[model samples]
Target: RTLPCSGRNLLPSTCGENRRRVVRALATREPNLRPGIPDLNVLRSGIAAVLSVALAWALRSDSLLWASPVSVVPQQWITEQRTISGVVVSVSDGDTFRLQNVGPFHPTQDRHHEQSFPVRLAGVDAPEISHFGNPAQPFSEEAKEWMKQELLGKSVAVHILGRDQYGRIVGSVRYTSGLFSHDLATELLRRGFATIYRGRGASYDGDLSNLEATEINAKAQGVGIWSLPDEELPAEYKRRTRARAF
Candidate 1:
């Protein structure tokens, strides 16, 4: 006769075989134990191990990392769709700005207990302004000054796309004043203050073709940076500078 264990019934034949195996294993481990009896300690340990494994399996997720805790910081802003709204407090360039009053929490570089962070425009690259004594690219100041006038102290909606290598939030910025609404990237491209970003992870909201058309029109009109005959792309300029440094 085979006894049921742990509220589960087993086939009589299989249960008898399993019992014999356990008895043999226990006897080998404890040489002085009675022939048909298992040590109470051994029985308790075996039950504990079985329960632990069952509990672990129950909590397992599809991810290989097991059951990971939910992050306080959101990890899937790009694919999962996340957005943050705040006022543009500062304009660094045609395609970069500082946003504040997001919340009581800031993801990076919290200053004086204020929720503020820098945001880089997705799907566009503006000319580099003079920094560290480097000469400014043509129309860099024009781009920056124009953005400051247009965006400084304005409330805007940011659609988060991803984070850049520099740890800046990369997103699409939408500005609304009265009844007029405009996207920062499209406006920059339209005025030739910036170019379509061809780098990796160049994400944007809305139709991509619209931005392309805007850039094409700017080029046809020979306006802003397009007026220069030998205008260098910001990405290309950065590469050249790095190569020269090396």
Candidate 2:
């Protein structure tokens, strides 16, 4: 007798349960099936089970929609946002690094034309390192060196927000070792190597109070960048550099 309802005709959401039921029904009536002929029901179920497992694995492999703890990526960037894990290949400055082996290609991959992706620490801005032989800001090299020591060769989880105007990925980075974990931006602010990003177009998705509190404490102690009686904000420095270009 033909196996009625192979579940291939049903809606996708209902297929799993229906398939399981069909498999159970077939198992119970196995002896009743033709003595010499093969049972088509068992073969069909086996195929279904394998296909279902493959589909599920493919979906899980998609890094673009993996669920994560509350991220700093703004709501507008959700569709293009995601999390990726990779080893830190290089540190550009206090707030930027290149991550390699991020696993699976993504639409928001930086335009750097390389395997490693560039990521900017979200919600904070570090001192600017000179480009094109321009003057470097105070503690710029220190910031870079500190980041290298902290992140170089270590694995990190990057919560991608979106691309910056420079085409670098803007996101939050979390570093976990043993039983302790810390957010990269928060630590930078706590040490005064960076400041709360007050620039326009820089927005975060969650509560801003914690970052603000960390900055306040760092400033109170007058450490790092805050130690300068009249420190030039990174934004101001960039603006000044632009004005001089003309």
Candidate 3:
């Protein structure tokens, strides 16, 4: 007799015997099964794992560093410049600020819906503010105070560059009109509140010559942090402070 499904000849074979052999073969080849469907046990395990991840995601109160599947499509980074209009709500420091009521010039479905978020000034590095009992970097307070007086509650246009690792938008902030029409970062450099940040992996499409020139002028004028004979860069100051703590 020959089984119709498998087309295999079975001498003195019973239907029950043929069925048992077929089941055994399937079990043996389960790992290499076509269509990639796992056996019942493995399928159950996969389902459980998926359920666990979903539950964890749902229960998470804050940011989760979830591992996502590799995407086939290339991610579209913000290479092209974008302009947004918003009023400064808060100044975190000389080079970082918070904006409220932000709206993009060209609205799209993918545009951020949040009314406010942190903005880090591009092409500039400001002195670090005091925190956790660590001494503030030279001119840190002056930088923050200057920003507060000049930017807080003021409407401005943000020339979007890209986002930083801390999720803050990196951009060149400028007033829409008036005497203070130049980029905020350049102004900070001119006032010696910030230095031209040319650190590795820095990304800023805007011309940095103005920032460099302003910084040189500030240093020559002995203004702000430049007045200190041995002022340390903000990054160096942070490294030294952290080293001292431990």
Candidate 4:
């Protein structure tokens, strides 16, 4: 079952994990779903993913929103709802990935994707060139570049939330290339390129504030943007600029 994007507290009663995986799903994947109790694990994870992917196709009903260099695609669309798993074959930017399985589809019947997927980041907002200044902030480009470099052409485990407003897969970028990885929010903070977007008033996004504090500490240490006085504007002005755009 799917839950609201703003509901983090709901997960404690849903998934066995203490943290809210629901928020992770919605914020990252923006899936179409009504709140319900869900179990998180290998089998359940596959089912939820396929459910979301099928739902996304139904909502979109258009052309392919994404493609990848080496994607595992099905010759036919999902005719029935089922779970599937795969590695990310591509990353669109800071928050989106294209995934297709490697080796072989999960041996479990109805447990894997034979096609690639295009997914959206759920909760956090990274600086898009469109939202930046007229020419766009140089740092925004840097941030995107860094994100692409870091995750592009990597293998990732995706957890689905269903379709979003645009019908893209709503999932998180977990393990990549058989290694643990940081989500977009963490990378943004690590690079000193983003803020929590507190004004947008997202639920799990506040969790990003914890990362923001880490960014502050990194800045204090003169890292990334902090290394440059010109790019380092007062917090108040930074907020104003971001607000005006997004």
Best by lDDT: 2
| Candidate 3: residue pairs that collide | none
> What is the lDDT for 18 in model 2?
68
Question: Candidate 1: lDDT of 30?
Answer: 36
Per-candidate TM equals 0.64, 0.66, 0.61, 0.44
Candidate 1's displacement at residue 114, Å, is 5.6
- Residue-pair clash count for candidate 4: 14
lDDT of 4 at 187: 62
TM-score pick, better of 2 and 3: 2
| Per-residue accuracy of model 2 over 1-246 as CA lDDT, tens digit each | 333454555533445676677667767873667677878888999999998996677546646332222233334444567676766778989899987643334333332325566788889899999897679999888888989988887778877777888877888888975689988888888888998898866855363788999999999999889999999978888899988887
lDDT of 1 by residue, 97-164 (tens): 87773432333343222345778999899999887666788889899998998887666777877788
Error of 3 at 32 (Å): 82
- Please write out the lDDT profile of model 3 over residues 92-148, one tens digit for every residue: 888898766333332333223244578888888999998889878889999999899
Deviating ranges (above 4 Å) for candidate 2: 1-80, 103-113
- lDDT score at residue 169, model 4, on the 0-100 scale: 62
Q: Per-prediction count of colliding residue pairs?
A: 0, 0, 0, 14
Q: What TM-score quantifies how close candidate 1 is to the native fold?
A: 0.64
Candidate 2 weakest lDDT stretch, 10 residues: 65-74
* Backbone clashes, candidate 3: 0
Q: Global CA lDDT of candidate 4, please?
A: 0.52
